[model samples]
Target: MRVGLFIPCYINAVFPQVGIASNKLLKSLGVDVDYPEDQTCCGQPMGNAGFENEAVSLAKRFDEKFKDYDYIVGPSASCVVFVRDNYGRLRIQPNHQCVSEGKIYEICEFIHDVVKPTHLKAKFPHKVSLQNSCHGVRLLHLSSCSEQNVPYFNKMRDLLTMVEGCEVAEPERPDECCGFGGMFSIEEKAVSVQMAHDKVQRHLATGAEYITGADSSCLMSQNGIIASEKLPLKTIHIVEILAAGL
Candidate 1:
């Protein structure tokens, strides 16, 4: 099927490789992926800052750019959720509402829900821990939450385990926020840094060589701390691992 890849603005500027892996992995699974070159942020930062007027303009732009696609898929759950959740508040046109309401997907959830592939040609032999982004867990519902007391099922881990020799481990607090709430990180640097450091400590306690997650925002947040502190653990987007096996 033809799919439009939505690479968040931050990922476009700083973590483009994650977008590459997402595109390559989807194509490997027979998806025809097209990236709308004019795409920018999904307007999450603006909306979160109470700038709905500004956000609506960008959301309309996004709708115009991507509404005709078969599906909109991306590596960042937060961005996907932003479009799904806030586009309505922007009073998106009736004809265009469905684009935000239904046809979008975060990469891993897309694999599990849409592709539904039980096997893959990819393989990554490594000890890796999963970092659950807040938007991914709470908004996108990427995986089961620990606080829910429900059956433990992680769609992200499902794909990770499919990699030929990948070993997935969970942190003590699997779905806790990594503290990178976009503007929240900037306005509250101390709390954000502390939250990220605590998350790194839990991931490192797993003794894994790499820390992987579906959201680049979280990985990028922890990576800053890891680099500054000279931590041995490394961070990577989950799509990178899923693509590595191919």
Candidate 2:
């Protein structure tokens, strides 16, 4: 199946390696993946910032860009889930069919559910605390939500386990939000900072050398705190870890 890679704006500007690793990982799995050069923001920022109308054109543009692909996969769960769940409400084109609505998926979700690879060539010898970004856990169901009584399953954790020498650990609060809710952090600065502080301390408590997750957005925010406090931790996207040594 043909796949289109959707790199979120923040990841493109900041953690470009994550996008590169995502492409490399998918290609190594023998998937036909292509990057749409003209693609831009998925409008998740504007939509989450209380400006849904501004995201309409972006939603339409995203739909047009990847409509032909069998699946549109991105590294960020929040952006993918936004398109999957909110595009229908954007009223773009025919309004009857949002081509990308059902096809878009977070990279980890696509790999775990669709590619179903049993092993990877990746090997990273380090302990990493898995950061279950809210969107990935709650919206995309990338992992079992702590608040729910579902059978425990963590797609990210499973993927990381494939990397030889890599040890995956979870913070005390496995699925807590890192307070990087797109615009939620900007609007609720105080609350967001406190939440991030709490989240980071828990990850540190796990004695992990690195904090890894499917969403780079959350990592970016936590990295800010780590940098400011000079904490003994680093943030790496799960794709980068899964693509290690490859």
Winner by TM-score: 2
| Model 2 lDDT, full chain set | 0.92
lDDT of each: 0.88, 0.92
- On the 0 to 100 scale, the lDDT of residue 80 in model 2 is 91
Each model's TM-score?
A: 0.96, 0.98
Candidate 2 regions exceeding 4 Å error are none
- Report how far off residue 78 is in candidate 2 (Å): 0.5
Return the lDDT, model 2, position 26: 98
Q: What is the lDDT of residue 140 in candidate 1?
A: 86
Q: What is the clash tally of candidate 2?
A: 0
Q: What tens digits encode model 1's per-residue C-alpha lDDT throughout 43-108?
A: 888888888888878888898899788889989888888898778767878544546557889999
lDDT of 2 by residue, 65-142 (tens): 998999999999888989999999888766487899989889999999999999999999999999999989989999
